[model samples]
Target: MWHPGLVDVVYATVAGALLSTAVVAARAGSPHRTPSRTALVAAVGTLGVSFLVQSPAARGVQNHLVADLGQLTGNGTSLVAAYALRVMVLHVRYDRDTAAARARRWLVALVVAFVAMTVLFLATPTVPGRFTSPDAPAGVVAYYLIFTSYLGATLVSLALLLGRYLDTAGGRWSRLSLHLHRAACVAGLIYLAGRVVALLVGRPRLEGSGQRFNLIELGVTILMPAVVAVLFLLGVLIGRGERWLRHRRAYRRLRPLWEAARAARPHAVLPVTGGGARLRLYRRIIEIQDAQLAAAQVLDAAQRRRIDGAIAGAALTGESAAAVREAALLAAGLAVLRDGRAAGGDGGPVTGAADQEVDLSAAVARLERVSAAWTGSPVVHRLAAPPEPANPR
Candidate 1:
């Protein structure tokens, strides 16, 4: 008696998008392929299929077909869990023979479970568009056996994944893998638990024309897909998010050097690019390098000596020294340029050696360091300070 609604449409849309993004991500050259990535892609693809089958659009006809597909989707969870376990064991460097033996045993179990689910669903037709209640007693029993067993298996796999993650040492791959595995595990557990609860307690009472519907099943159907989709998408984005923040921070840090150089030679600055952090960072690097080159042409020997003295006086070392030295020199150059312009001296480029290639990465890192210490740097403060009037002569 259930009907397709807005919730089903929304779930389908989101699931479709998630599946598409996963497919794109999975398309690395074959050289980059790994068992873990392959299994994850398969899991996401199979989950998308489940979303499609459960969607309102697929409900009007072919009830048996949809039921079979649903059973198959449970196997997808098993596949992902098996591969995740394999990855974890490999990461921990378990003895190869033992690991392979354990993996083979699990694979056999997974195949048996999949086969059992398929056979059971084929034997009993699902009540079209109604998962909570089936017309026959056999159908009811089949439903519970297939789902609860699958759910129990899934829960075990997820527990293993979580436990391994917690026990293992930390690394970039470990963190990213944990994020992906954790989201998938949490989403699957929630959906599976909800279904089990509904199956146990959502009984129907005979009424005049029909039976009382299970509200729990209805809510679960409407909500689970959306929740899972969002979490999965977030897991995919975690690494990208960290990279973006890093690049953006570096871009902002270089603002002081870029601004000072641009002031002396505005034409050196390039037009800003649009879109994400990576594009902007690339443009920032190019423009900052260009500005430095232009500024070098205008700086005189006397001004250069002053900047060198400021760098020596800064008395910094290591990465910090590299950053502060660049900032102090640039600040001194800006001061000299400003004074020259104020005194009616042309700020034109003076003949100098040809431009050398800039180390964009190092420059950006140093600039970021400079930005971090700008307010506190004595050299910067001195360069920026107004000249003291000569003592009364």
Candidate 2:
């Protein structure tokens, strides 16, 4: 059997992680009211509350009434969480109207189950710690049965939904989160099954059966749900980490281009400051776009055609070819500005539709390509070079 102190430590750790995950999810979704975001936040937040109320530390000092109330609250919240998870998956898998209809039916069923469990608990005679004994009244047994049955069913349904969703999930982080949630559901089912067996067979008899039996019961009844909690926490962390890394990577990739743009038109730089990686990237893209417009004003048709011909002859394609051409044009314009052959146009920045309509990710990707070509492309290098000085005969 596991040491009692070690079990307490594990339980405490899992509870803390669950609570942290809930807080993070709530904050992350605070700005959005999309069905998927709201459902996910509700699911995680309720699950965290369930575990917190049922924790050993919280239950240790409670009187009989308080303990019973805590148990009912924990079980009710857990059921709600299960339903919310199902709704979240539904929103992901089906259209909003269909998902909403199905979710309403499930929510009604959960409410009924919770009410039945509460009524059964209240009808049972007052016992210390409420249902701690194997010989507890039939009312207590019925209460547990309803709670376990409804929760088990919800977990099974959630697992099935997640399995179907997993097959079609395209993003790496999405698949990972689904896999973690599916594993948590399986662990929840195991915990519920153990609750059912213990309720029917008596906990004392199971403990007296054998050391091996006791160990198995302890693991299934206690450790299984802890595993579920940890899995939920991991799912939250993994998704957050993936998004942070993507934003940070995009910010880094755009740095060289942003620098070039700043050098070319120092006066056009925006005065924005103090934001996260994603916001910084947005600012950088806008500044680079402003510089590109400035460059466009100085270049005549011949210079534009020459840059395009050079890119085409170099056998580049797609965004890379376009990026190289843009880089050459910008460099040539900057050269002309330096030589005083062409005016730098109006000090006021020119606004264009291309910056407003392109998707942020696509814009970042194209600019990243341009950044690479600006520094490394030999064809761009030749075109960006200043015109040769005239020779006198």
Q: Which candidate number would show the highest lDDT if scored against the true structure?
A: 2
Q: Please give, for residues 292-330, the per-residue lDDT of candidate 2 as tens digits.
A: 777767766666677778878889897677778777877
- Local distance difference test scores for all models: 0.57, 0.73
TM-scores for candidates 1 onward, in order = 0.53, 0.75
- Any runs in candidate 2 off by more than 4 Å, and if so which? 1-11, 28-35, 60-62, 95-102, 129-179, 201-217, 267-274, 290-303, 326-363, 385-393
Worst lDDT window (10 residues) for model 2?
344-353
Prediction-by-prediction clash tally: 0, 0
Residue pairs that clash (backbone atoms under 3 angstroms), model 1: none
lDDT of 1 by residue, 1-393 (tens): 355677567757876875786686576333235555565566566566666655666544444556535434534553444444444444344565665676677567666766666676667665553444533345545655665565456556655766676577354744774566576657667776776655554344333434334454555656664676666666666655666677788887767666766776576667664656766776666665565444455455555466557767767667665555555545544555655643321243321122232544554665566666555677767755224335897
For model 2, which pairs clash? none
Superposed Cα deviation of residue 321, candidate 2 (Å): 3.0
Relative to the unseen true structure, what is the C-alpha lDDT of residue 28 in candidate 1, on a scale of 0 to 100?
A: 37
